[model samples]
Each structure stands twice: as C-alpha cells, then as structure tokens.
Target: MCVYVVDDDPRICRLLARLVGLEGFEVHTFEKAAMFLENLTRLKFGHVILDIDMPEHNGLDVLDHILHQKPYWPVIIISGSTAMDDAITAFRRGAIHFLRKPFRRDDLRAVLSEARKVGVKRIAAYELQARVMQVKLTGRETQVLDAMAGGLQSKMIAWKLGLSIRTVDMHRSNILAKLSARNSSQAVAIARGLGLTQ
Candidate 1:
C-alpha cells in the first residue's frame, strides 16, 4: 500500500518518507493540504500521515475534506501541539490515530500496522457495497429480503407489509432466484454478506 505524508516542513516530510519507505510502503509527500486534496482522486489505496499545523489549510480542515470525500480512508494526525482539545477534536472527526510530534518510531509503526488492518477491512466493505449495488432488486423484493433477514416467516412478512401470503411467497422466490440461493436462510446470509441486509 501507499503512504501519503502531508506536512509543510520539508525536513519532516523527507524524514517521514524515508521512515515509511523503509517499512516497504510506497511513499508520496505533499507540502500543502491543497496539493493533497487536489490530487486526491489520483491517489492509490493508502493511509495518510498528516501534520496538524500547516499554511493555507490546517490538518483538521483537510481531515474533514478527506472524510467527506472518502469516509473509509484512514488518517493519522501528527502534531506538535499538546492541547488535549486538538486530540479530542481529531478523534471526534474520525482520525484513526493521533501522535505527538517527535513521536517514537515504534508508536508510528504500531499505528501504521493498525491502519493497515483497518484499510483492508474498509476496502473489502467498499467492494462488497459495490457488488451489492450491481444486483438490482425491486422495492418490494428488498423489503421481503430485509424481513427474511429479520427471521420473519412469509405469513408474518405478508402481514407486516400489508400483502397477501401468496404475494410474499412470490417475492421470496424471486429474491432467492436473483440471489442464486437455495433457501430463505441462504438468501438472508448472502444478503448480509453483500451488505444488502443488516
């Protein structure tokens, strides 16, 4: 995976590039938050190491933009500020980890390891969501599938949906065929796996 470092300090950026590179990740450095945001669409799957203090745009603003555009991307904050509020705000804004400036190599490594695992899960979830989107289901079929996932029988689902039992059964059969599942249980399982049902 790639590691994108956003810090205004050239020395710090170079140090982070070298350090992260040694860990076998491709490294990209940006001196400004605007540059990072502008190039976001071109970036590969990766985590970000961002410094809180920078000219033009601060880390928190950039963090907000990142989360807005790509909610699953992991962002690690590196700041010299010791203010507890900054750390709290960072976490509240969905930062994966916050490291104080002059942070130890071991601490960065640990967070990067954690971020890698998180990144993998996020990617898998995105892929599953994409696959789920490709499977077209009618509104009523979706309702039936959701009711099935909730462990509702055909009679119960029909009553809840204000539909006849035969209509509910037809929807169930269509859902099973569309999902390529043999039974209601298997259909529910597949729907959950594809993120179509909770």
Candidate 2:
C-alpha cells in the first residue's frame, strides 16, 4: 500500500517516510497541500498522514477537499497541539485519527492498523452500495442521511437543512432502519460506501 505523508516540516516528513517505508509500504512526502493535490490523482489507493497546521491552507481545508472528492478516503490528522476541539472537529470531518506530534512508534503502528481496517471497511462499503441503492429513501431522508454521513449531529443537520429537530430525528431513525445500521456512525459508513456523500 502507498502512504502519503503531508507536513510542512521536511524533517517530520522524512521521519514519517522512513518509518512507514520500513513497513514495506511506498511512502510519498509533500511539503504543501497544493503539491499533494497535484499528485493525488496518481495515488489510486492509500492512507493519508496529514499534518493539521500548514501555511496557505490549513489541514482541515485540505481534509475537506479530499473528502469532497473521495468521501471514503482514509485520512489521519496529526498535529503538535493537543486541543480537544481540534480532535473533535477532525473526527466530525471524517478523520480516522487525530494523532499528536512526537507520537510513539507503536502509536503510529496502531493508527496505521486502524486505518487499514477502515480501508477494508471502505471496500466493503463500496460493494454494499450497489445493494443499498435498492432501498427507497425520501428526498429529505436522503438529505438527512447525507448530512449524517458528514458527521453532523442531528441539531446541526436540522439547522443546516432547515428542518425541525423532531423531523431530523425522525429522518435519522428512518435512515438507520433503511440502512440496517444500529447507529448514526454505521449509517454514515453505509452512506459513504454507497457514494451518497458526494
């Protein structure tokens, strides 16, 4: 598998490339988001190790762009700061993990393992998408499901979609039932696999 490491610091990029390369994976390092985006089309399949703080465009913006193009893409956000808000926001933005800088090698390994599992899940989701489209969801339910896949809470979804909280809750329930998902996260996963997020 290939791994794309995006960080402003060349030293950090080299460290990650070396560490990941040692694992028998092809590693590519980028010092800027534009460079990364330029080369992204060449990377058919891979996990991204993205640093959150970068000049020109922040990590979140990059992440947003990536997800817009590929919702099921596996991205792990890394930063020097341990801000809880940032971590939460990353998760809400569909990051697999938010790792702090200077992380232990074992931690990196663990995160990579988790990302691999997510990759597997994404493949399965793609397969399931074909079947999922058979289920009929109303326009609003589809909209709500799309929002849920974006990691938005019911309240936020309601506000964004200009619906009542009760309506959002109802749509969430219907979406979960239709998708056979136990919760919002699973529903979102299924939605992502179905290519419904874009």
Candidate 3:
C-alpha cells in the first residue's frame, strides 16, 4: 500500500519516508497541507500520516476533507503536541491512529500494518459495489441516475443528455427497478451508498 506523509518539517518527512519505505511500502511526502489538498483528487488511494500543527489548513481540517470525500482511506495523526484534546479531536474526526513525535519505529510499523489490512478490505468492498452497479445498470441508466443524484429532474436530464423527457423517465424507471428502489429518491440514495454516483 502507498503511504503519504504530510508535514511541514522537512526532517520529520524524511524520517517518515525512510522508515515507511524500509517496510516495503511506497511513500510520498508533502511539505504543505495546501499542496496535498490541491492534489488530493488526482492522487491514488493511500494511507496518510498527517501532522496536526501546521501553518494553515491543519491536519484536522485535512482529515475532515479526506473523510468527507474518501472515507475509506485511513489517516494517522502524528503530532508533537502533548494536548489530550488533540487526540480526542482526531479520534472524533475518524482518524485510524494517533502517534506522538519521538515515537518508536515499531509503533509506526504496527499502525501501518493494521491500516494496510483495513485499507485492503475497504477497497475490495468498494470495487465489489462498483462491479454490482456495472452489472445492474446500463450505461445510459447510470448517467441518468448520476444526474438525478445531482438534483436534476427528468426534464433537465433529458435536455442535458439530448434525449426526450419520456426516454429519461423510462431510464429513471429502469434504474429504480434494477436497484429495487421504490422511487427516484430511493434510487439516488442507493446509488450514493454504492459509491456509484459522486
């Protein structure tokens, strides 16, 4: 599994990269929270080692954004702060682990090992859900369902897709049937749960 180390301290980043690399995992280091957040969408799925104390966009903010967009990715908080409140906040925000600075290498390795196992399971679940959607919905039906999830009515979807309103409605009906949903709203909810629609 890939591991991303985000810290403003160059020394800490280098130490983490070296340690994680020795464990046979790919490592990427970012010196700024903004830089990491800007490239978040383009980066592949991986575990994150984040520092809570940063100039702007602290680790908690980044953690929230990651959970909001990619809840499956594991985040490990590494901070020099001794405040118990920081640890509490990190756990509350869904961090997988918390490590203090000057921590043992063995501790870091253990956390990464655990994160990798959980990451594999979550990724497999996502892929399975995606395959189920692919098997159940036609290409056009998926498009229509995505549009519905985006709060577009059949008329708007029809105009955007250059299809008749009747055709769009038909696709919506098919989506509902294939997903075993009672209504368009239910279909959208199912699609979202399956991670089929953004």
Candidate 4:
C-alpha cells in the first residue's frame, strides 16, 4: 500500500511519512498541494493525508479539486482546528476522515490499515500492469546480471557461477560495452526504457 502526505511544513511531512512507513505503507511526501495534485492522475497513492492549513492551497480545496478530477480518491484531512464546523466542512467536502493534529501513532496506524484494506484491490490490479525493467543479457550473461543486480561483486558472482573472476570481469566489460552504459545504474535505466524486465 502507498500513502501520500501533503503539508507546507516539510518536517511534519517527513515525520508523518516516517510514521506511515513504519506501518508498512510506502510513503511519499510533498511540501505543496499543487505539486501533489499535478501528479494525482499518474500516481496511485493508497491513502492521502492532507494538511488543511497549507500556504498556497487549502486542504479541502485541494481535495475538492482532486475529486473533481477523480471522484473516488481516498483522503484524510489533518488540521490543528478543534472546531466542529471545520470537521463538518471537511466531511462535507469529501474527506474520508478528520485527523486532528498531533495524532497518536496507533490511530494513524489503524487509519492506514483501513486505507490499505480499501486501496489494496486497486493497488494489486495496478501492480499487475506495472513492470520492473532489468538489464539485457544473454542466457549466460543474464545469470551474471541477476547476480550483480543483487549487489554481488564480480568475485562473488564468479564463485557462485563456477567461473574465474577474470572471466566474470570480461563478461561484465562486454555487457557494459554493448549497452553503452557508464555504470550499472545507467544500464538498469536504459534497459527499463527498452522494456527488458517484462
């Protein structure tokens, strides 16, 4: 499951994300409501925790905009306000829950768990459509690549594959030479673009 937090306060955003992450949800933090909204269509966050008091855009306004774009997006609104009117306004504006500021970890965890239960159906379906790109390699070189992908050094790969380290290095050189990659990260990215890890 994924969780998104949008707050003008970067510290709060980071803290909340870390808390959610501890609950086993993948977390993404955005300092501005506008930036998060820009990626709303392309990004599928399981649950969104929004701050109502952001400088540029109010949380309810952002939520309304998101709903206008995608009616059923799940969200929770957070605020320091204790006014019943604010909570009512949040619900009327389509917030899933109203979380007061300085919420307890257990409460957040429970909310996140509930969000995942609801969001997993969609996340699972999307995961099937998602692809992880891997590097290109021949049958033999693929073995080498997979090992390297695991962070095994050349000597370790060679030992695992019953080959000399020099042989492994030669294969690595050939692989890099063919792919025109400056390093492993670049190679992995290029391979992804070409759809190698389907």
Sort the predicted structures by lDDT, highest score first.
1, 3, 2, 4
lDDT of 4 by residue, 30-122 (tens): 998989989988986557899998879977889898777755557788898888887899889887788898899888887777666656665
Per-residue lDDT for 35-105 in model 1, tens only?
A: 89999977788999999888778789999998888888899999999999999999999999999999888
**How high is the lDDT of residue 121 in model 3?**
89
Judge candidate 2 against the unseen true structure and give its global Cα lDDT, from 0 to 1. 0.87
Which sections of candidate 1 miss by over 4 Å?
Answer: 139-188, 195-198
Q: CA lDDT, every prediction?
A: 0.91, 0.87, 0.90, 0.77
RMSD of 4: 12.3
Q: Write the per-residue lDDT of candidate 2 for residues 41-142, one digit (tens) a residue.
A: 666788899998887778998998888777777999999987899899999998999899889988999889888889879867765775766878899998
Q: Clash pairs of candidate 1?
A: none
TM-score of each: 0.77, 0.64, 0.67, 0.59
Off by over 4 Å in 2: 130-198
Candidate 3 structure quality by residue, lDDT tens digits, 1-198: 789999999999999999999999999999998898888888899999999998877789899998788888989999999999999999999998999998999999999999999899888898866757565778999899889998999899999999999999999988888778899899888788777788
